[model samples]
Target chain A: MTIRYPNGKLYTPHTSVQKTEKKSKSKDLSFSNRGKTLEDEINEANDYYIKRRLAIIHKKPVPVQIVKVEYPSRSAAVIREAYFRTPSTTDYNGVWNGHYIDFDAKETASKTSFPLKNIHEHQMTHMQQVTEQNGVAFIIVRFSAFERYFIVPYEVLQKAWQAMENGNRKSIPFSTIEEEAYEIPTSYYPRIDYLPIIQQLIVEKCCGFESEEK
Target chain B: MTIRYPNGKLYTPHTSVQKTEKKSKSKDLSFSNRGKTLEDEINEANDYYIKRRLAIIHKKPVPVQIVKVEYPSRSAAVIREAYFRTPSTTDYNGVWNGHYIDFDAKETASKTSFPLKNIHEHQMTHMQQVTEQNGVAFIIVRFSAFERYFIVPYEVLQKAWQAMENGNRKSIPFSTIEEEAYEIPTSYYPRIDYLPIIQQLIVEKCCGFESEEK
Candidate 1:
C-alpha cells in the first residue's frame, strides 16, 4: 500500500516499495527536480526574505487531530492514532513592508486550465475575509507543465471562483489566468519573489493605477 | 506510568492504570476545573471573535518531526515515531481591524513572577522582528494559580527578556507585570477577551497617549 505524507511525499510499505517508487518517479517526470515542488520554492523564498529582514512570512504547520497516545518513557509520549486536520486559513500569512500578506501556493499539472477542485471552498472564503479586512491576499499558481508561475490577486480569484460556482467553467482557463494574473519572473536568491508583485498589486489597488499604468 | 500531552493533559498508560489514576487526581488538586486550561480559554475567545467576523486570529498547529510511519491500509497511514519541534514563531497571528496581530499565550503556575523559561528565545526573537515590521506583537500571560490574565505589550516583554539576558532577575516579577500589563477581565462568550486591550494599546502607541493615560 502507498500512503502520502503531509508534505506530499508517498510512502510505501517495504513489501511493495519498488512499485510506489515507480509511481512517484512518473509523477515527477515532467518537472525539473523530483523532490522540489511549488511549496518548496515558496518556502525557500520565505527563508530568503527572512534572512534579509524583508518579510516574516511562514507556512503554518500542518494540523493534526490526535485520538490516542502512548507513553513509552517518562519524557516521551507517542501519538498512536491521529488524523490530518483541515486548515482554517491559507497556508502562508505574515507582515511584509508594514502590510498584511496572505496567500496560498498551488500547482497544477494541467497544461491549459487550472482545475477548480485544486482549491478548497474554505480557502477561497478565507481569502475573501482577509481581503475584506484590508489585507493583501492572493494565490500563487504554478502551471507545472509549462514551468510558469503567476500571482493571481484575490479579486481575480474571486471572479474565477464565482464563475465556476455560477456554472461558467469547471476550471480556470490558462489564457484567462495569463491575462489576469501577474507573471512572477523567476529569480535565483529568492526563487519565487512574489512580494514585489504583491506590493505592486497593493499600490495599484490603493491608488487606482489602472489607467496610469495603461 | 503517566504521560503529559502537549496541551498539558495527563495520559496514564493502560498498564497498572489504577496506580497512575491516583497520581492524576492529586495533580489536579489546585485548579478550579481539571479540564479547562488557559489555552482552552484563549481558543474559545478566538472562536467567538471569528464567528462575529471581528478578527481572524488562529493558533498555529504544534509542529512535529515524523521519523517513522506505518501503513495498515490503502488510505490509513499512522505515524509510528515523531517528536515535538520547537516553533520558530509565536503561536497565534492574524489580521484584525486592518492591523496585523501576533502573539503568544503563556500560563504560569507561579503566583509572584513569570519565569523567563516559560517562553523560548526564538519566540521572543520572532516577536521582536514582528514589532520591527510595524506589526502589533504581544503576549497574553495567565497566572493560573490566581486565575488572572494580562495582556503584556512587546515593549514590556522585551525589557524583561533583555534584563534576564543581562544577568538580572530570571523572572518578570508579578508586581512588574501587574504594573506594565493590562488586566484582561474575563467574559462569558469570549473568556479571555484580550483583543480590546490590544486595540487600546495600539491606539495609545500610535497617538502617544502614554502620558495622557497616566
Candidate 2:
C-alpha cells in the first residue's frame, strides 16, 4: 500500500511487515522491528493511551484543498482533484489531566544535530501561542540514526529558533538536545511513553502541585 | 466556487457576497448580513480570538483517504483519487486560559427542537472522553430558523443522548435548551464570541477560581 504523507510525499513501505512477522516469532523486542516512522509510533501510543484512559491525544488530519468532487450516490462521494494545504498548526494536540497538550513529531537522520529547517515558522508561532495560553507545548524529536527520542519544550525550542533568526547555528546540536530536552525511553506497549514526562513538567510548572488522576 | 464540507457535501454560495456588499452600504448590522453558516462564523470567531490573543482554537481538517496521486513536479502533487473518512472527534478544539476546550458546531432548521440525529455516536463518545479528562466539552447549536445560538454543555447533551438511546425522545426540545444552555448574543465582530462563555464555564467547573487574564 502507498501511504500519503502530510507533505504530499508517497512512501512505499519496505518488506518490513514480513520482517516484523518473522521477528515476532522470536517473542522478543528486536531493535530490527523498530522500522515504523515517528508519526506512526506516536499514533499507536495515542491509541494505547486512549484505551487505558490515560489521555486523549490525536493527530490532526492532513489538510487538503478539494477542487472537484464527484458524488455517485447519496452516500459515496469521490474526490477527483485535490491539493495538499500547508497546515496552520502542529500535528498532534489534546487534553491530558485537564491541561492542553500540543506538539509536533519530527525525526532527523543526522546523528549530530536536528536541523531548524525541520520546524516551520507557523508551527513555531502556534507553539508560542499555546505556551502563552499556559498550555503545554513541545516537540518530540527522534534522532533516527541513534534511535534516541527527546521531548523538547517550547521555551527551549523558541530560544534556539530566535538564536537561529539572529544569525546563530541553523541546527540544534545533539549535545544541546541531550541537555535541554527530556529523553523518552523506548517501550513496547505505548511505543514512546512521553506522557509521564509531560506529567512531571506539568507538576513542576504548576509549582509542584500535582493534578489528581482520574 | 464550490466548498467541500467534512461530510463531502458541496456548498455553492448564493450571491451572499453581493448581498453582503450591498448591506455594507447601509453601515448598520443588518440581520441580512447573518447569512454565513455556523461553521464559517465559528472559524471567523476563532480568527478574531487568535488576533486578540484571547484564545487559540481551530477546526480540524476534513479527513480524507487518498488512494492515488500524480506527482506532476517536485513541488506540486495532485490527488487523483480520494474518499472522505468519518471524523472520530469533534470539529473544533483548543486551549483557553490553561483549559482544554473541545466542541462541535451544529445547526438546526427545526424551530421546535434540535434532533439527536444531528450528532453521531462517535462524537458523543469523544466528548465523553474529553470531559473525563476534565476538559471542557460542549456543542454550539445554531437555531437557524430562530436566529438563536446556544452553547450546550456536554453533560446536558449526554443526558439527552442517553434518553434517546433508552428509546425516549429522539430530539431535544428547544425549551429545554433555552432553560439549560447559555445563550450567546449575536455580534458583528467575532460572530460567535464563545470564549467568554467558555471562561465562565471554566470558572464554574474550577470551583469559582478564575484563571488570570494574560
DockQ for all models, in order? 0.41, 0.72
Q: Give the local distance difference test score of model 2.
A: 0.83
Residues A1-214, model 1: lDDT tens digits: 2445455676332322122222332434333443456777888889988888888999998887766777887787877677677888899999986688899988776777888887899999888888877888988987766666799888887898889889898888899888888888665445568878888887888887763332
Model 2 C-alpha lDDT per residue in residues B23-106, reported as the tens digit of each score: 322333343335566777888899998988999999999999999999996668999999999999999999988999999998
Question: In model 2, what lDDT does residue A53 have?
Answer: 87
Give Cα-based local distance difference scores for all models: 0.77, 0.83
lDDT for model 1: 0.77
Predicted structure with the largest DockQ when compared to the true one: 2
- The top-ranked prediction according to lDDT is 2
- As a whole number from 0 to 100, the lDDT of residue B164 in candidate 2 is 92
Q: By DockQ thresholds, what CAPRI class is model 1? A: acceptable
